[model samples]
Target: MASLIDNNSNVCSMEEEIEAEAAVLKQIQNRLAEKMEVGKTAPPTEEEQKEIDARSIFIGNVEFGATVEELEDHFKGCGEIVRTTIPKDKLTKKQKNYAFIEFESSDSVENAMVMNGSTFRERQIVVTSKRTNKPGMGAQRGRGGIRGGIRGRRGGQQTVVVKYVYVNGAAPRGRGGFRGGRGRFNPY
Candidate 1:
């Protein structure tokens, strides 16, 4: 009967030990979660991402020496900042002269946009709404397509380019270098 009492005491002590260890583990986990949130960025949920996007501003011509703290201080008057992202060159780890600042409210975004062309760290920064790279959107294709030459292929000369595409005879590919094939044959 004494041995049975001792066994019950041992089991109770073991249960208490397990509960103590679990409590310690839970505390550790909570501390680690706080550290992770402070030091590392976690991927935002879809709605959170959209909220961020809508409340963000694109800042162009940002000085290379600018830091997150400086940016937050500068825009603090606008509203509470959720994040500020300055893209860096992966190879050199240097700022790429641009940044994205996300605020906690649309009013903050408006206030930031009002600072467009304001001088920041000796550069005239362009502040605008954050733009996404959707097709048929953002900056247009820029002057665009097919280099013809210094003078370019004249409108009337397009036929010459079309005619030589399927020439069957011994055309011999004149002007074969950078000047390209087939000198304009006047054949008058």
Candidate 2:
């Protein structure tokens, strides 16, 4: 009889432990469901939603001193201005010579493209699709380890060479083995 009572007690303890575990599991599931419902039902604010829904247009080659207000004023002729932003330098806190202008509709962006190649602040402006690349992504990180290694092995174009030939086209001679030697006002 004592053995039978011990067996019954053990069974009851085991059953109680299982019931406690089940209760804990049920609570966890309830909390997860509540969190999911909150995430699904609570929508973003109007301003945030508008930012997400609005189209993005790139305004490149802007002046370094251009202000957000100035950008808005200039592009206002295109259409109903949604927002104008000029990315600032991380350390210097100055404009980075580029901007983004979002308009109320696609037509506004289309109209703004006409302003491309026009001079703003004495610098020619470039308008196109907003760069989709994430900020702070550098060439070192952009190329994976293997590709980066291969690129490192194959030396890339020298900055001075590229600037002289492609960009400025007036290569300073003598030092870089460029022909015609150094001239004061060399055009070609």
Q: Residue-pair clashes per candidate, as listed?
A: 0, 0
lDDT at position 6, candidate 1: 100
RMSD of each: 11.0, 13.3
TM-score of 2: 0.47
After superposing all C-alphas onto the true structure, candidate 1 shows an RMSD in angstroms of 11.0
TM-score of every candidate: 0.53, 0.47
**Top TM-score hit:** 1
Q: What is candidate 2's lDDT per residue for 88-176, written digit by digit as tens?
A: 88998887978988777877877888888988888899987554454455465322333213223334422332223544765354333
**What residue pairs are clashing in model 2?**
none
For all candidates in order, the CA lDDT equals 0.77, 0.71
Residue 35 error, candidate 1, Å = 13
